[model samples]
Target: MARLSGLFLCGALLSFACQDLGIAVEVKVPAEPLSTPVGKNAELPCSYSTSVGDSFALEWSFVPPGKPLSASHPILYFTNGRVYPTGSQAKRASLLQNPPTRGVATLKLIDAHPSDTGTYLCQVNNPPDFYTNGLGLINLTVLVPPSSPLCSKSGQTSVGGSAALKCSSSQGAPRPVYNWVRLGSSPTPSPGSMVQDEVSGQLILTNLSLTYSGTYRCVATNQMGSASCELTLSVTDPSKGRVAGALIGVLLGVLLLSVAAFCLIRFQKDRRKRPKETYGGSDIREDAIAPGISEHTSMRPDSSKGLLEKPSSASSVTTTKSKLPMVV
Candidate 1:
């Protein structure tokens, strides 16, 4: 029992000394890059040399390609015999070995996405053993096929004008290269008449003619796969278009004149059919105002003349019996 006690005291002293002196940590990772298709799993291998320590900790972080290390985003952490996940990758990232005390600190990623293609850092810390080589870097690439391209046209499609046809793919890994081809036999283009940019997928046609009118197909290809799109370009003569527009205008003018003539003719016919509007006074100025007054007014006044002779009896009687028409 006394010897065991002495041995325990020596061991305690040695452990304290080792902690103060510190041991260099060695971490290993693959030098070559690792690749996985999108939506697949990836294993980022990481290993370290160190005794299991109570103060041991493991961290996995990611930095997008072309970015500085300061942009590291934490994926997960392993400490105190528990796993604590962090960031968007928390649900997909995990340690290959639980309780990584056995030295393997490999990182496993499930359902890898295209956005996960970047640089990953695996770091191990065992207290005083963090003096050197405690971290490693890994490059991950997620393969993706080219998506369907969008085909479009720009500028004028009329003859003797400039025009452009464009094609592009919105999604692809390793960037897709574009190629343009006319579907059918095309006339040989004159020097400097046509220009095509494969990188930007733009086909420029200057001094366009009827020959340029055809179906064009663009193919985008990459390491994964290829996708294609098509567009139809129609060239026309501006003079013909102007003539058609003039003809349409003349037709519209004729239609408007016909409508106006029809309206005028209808107005005259309706006026002829309508009875004239008149008032009661119109009849008063006629030969006789009322039926009963006609006989009495027809009787001439007495032929005998006097210095101040009044109207004859027949005229007076006719005026008295006549009924005036009521005005509305």
Candidate 2:
């Protein structure tokens, strides 16, 4: 019994010495920040060095925030380049041999669940002396909805004019909610504000005025996040009144074009209806007299009476004028 007691005392002293020398038997993995997503693999990296390889026992364990570390079962263990068996880890965890000869024992997790997030520890122990140990922490964050709404105008508005604006999002989770925001800088409110189809998230300003202009923003949000956009607004001066003036100018232009076209068409139709005049004489004449003082009428050589009437100088009188009735 005395010998056993002495041996126990020696073992305790050796443990104290190992701890004093920083022989990490029970140790921390990493105290820094690390994050992982759900349903993905996460690696818990660890390494240790020891003087006694034959008696060294390397182990890995995980405990959530409030739980005790060693009280729970170890996830994985390695000893002398060989894997030690822990039956439950078969489905959820495995020991990864990353730089195995250098005493690096990394824990690989498959299909990590939300509950798997926690603080992990790596421990090393020898029969008479502790070698190395470490602690590491991992944080898992699940994404949420988008937030911070923004509304804006696409084009500038003139006084008493119409304008369109587009509202959109910058960042958020999938399927975010969108809305339009109308804000005024002045203390007094101008009450003629109107929005278009609020369900579709479009804003239309009709009959815009200087007082109606201010700032506009489109806001988008979700359960996990929120965002907003803003822009300064101003309307054209009343003196300019470009909206109504532009409309009037356009109407005037259209009216002038229509009048010009009508005149051109009437001129063309009149010219077509009137018989073409050639040297002030008709092509064919029956009872017409030539422009001369003779009472008998002169006929063209191509007329029906051309063969009847002999080719005479009197018929081809240059100054002959026909007594034809005036054309209506």
Candidate 3:
């Protein structure tokens, strides 16, 4: 009788201690992450020990990726035989089983979006029997494919110089990686002459040569799908350019010399055939003494010969003086 009384006293003290400090409760949850495509339903599995009572309660909360639990906001909760949905997802959030009193507190989400991608916390408290972490964590992800990437190039593509190829996408749920490939048959690049960055989507080439001239393609890829773009590089030789320019200059110089020589020869022929000025015929001078009339006198008739031989003035005077004296 004395031992029985002592045992009852010890049991009462033990129950009082349990009431002050809560006991451990077991919550069952999956070890793997959850996933679903956009615009589809998703299930985050959670459950606990069958500790149904008048004050039984359960809560589901969420936070974005990389955020702490302290930042989580309530999505839905159940207590006092009533279910209340809350937060931004309240309209589409619900429980898998009516009144999760049967131990199934799995979260049900309808038409999930990329914004819903994050971590979820499920907690349960059965009064007088819960204390040590009656909670579980779940990670959810939304799958998405890559978008068309923009292709571009930088630096001159001349021989003995360097060039870089770039590619990028404007929108994609999961960030994508890049890859490059030559369109036609291409020789293997020397070890140190080429460099590529898959994350940044860039390919750099040094010591460019004529063999590097070709069309190249870039592909952006993720878990869902891939998109691609294309670009071309044409390497030119500097020596060939110099040779062509010199040949053109020489041809122009020859053409100019030929034109100058033709002009000089034409001027000489025109000078040799030129005529001289004349001052004869109608332009004769009218001056000086009269010409002799001897030729005209000889051509006259014979009767006129006596007139041409008539006397000198001195002989006529001498004969006239004697005749005048005799008459007086």
Which residues of candidate 2, in runs, are more than 4 Å off?
1-28, 84-89, 98-101, 131-328
Candidates sorted by lDDT, best first: 1, 3, 2
Q: Please give, for residues 297-328, the per-residue lDDT of candidate 3 as tens digits.
A: 33223485554352334334222233454543
Model 3: residues with Cα > 4 Å off, grouped in runs: 1-23, 170-175, 186-188, 247-328
Highest TM-score: which candidate? 3
Provide the TM-score for each candidate, comma-separated. 0.63, 0.35, 0.67
lDDT of each residue in 195-225, candidate 1, tens digit only: 8898898988899999989999999998899
Candidate 2 TM-score, true structure as reference = 0.35
TM-score, prediction 1: 0.63
Q: Which candidate do you rate higher for lDDT, 2 or 3?
A: 3
Q: Better model by TM-score, 2 or 3?
A: 3
The per-model lDDT (C-alpha) reads: 0.87, 0.63, 0.83
RMSD of 2: 16.8
Models ranked on TM-score: 3, 1, 2
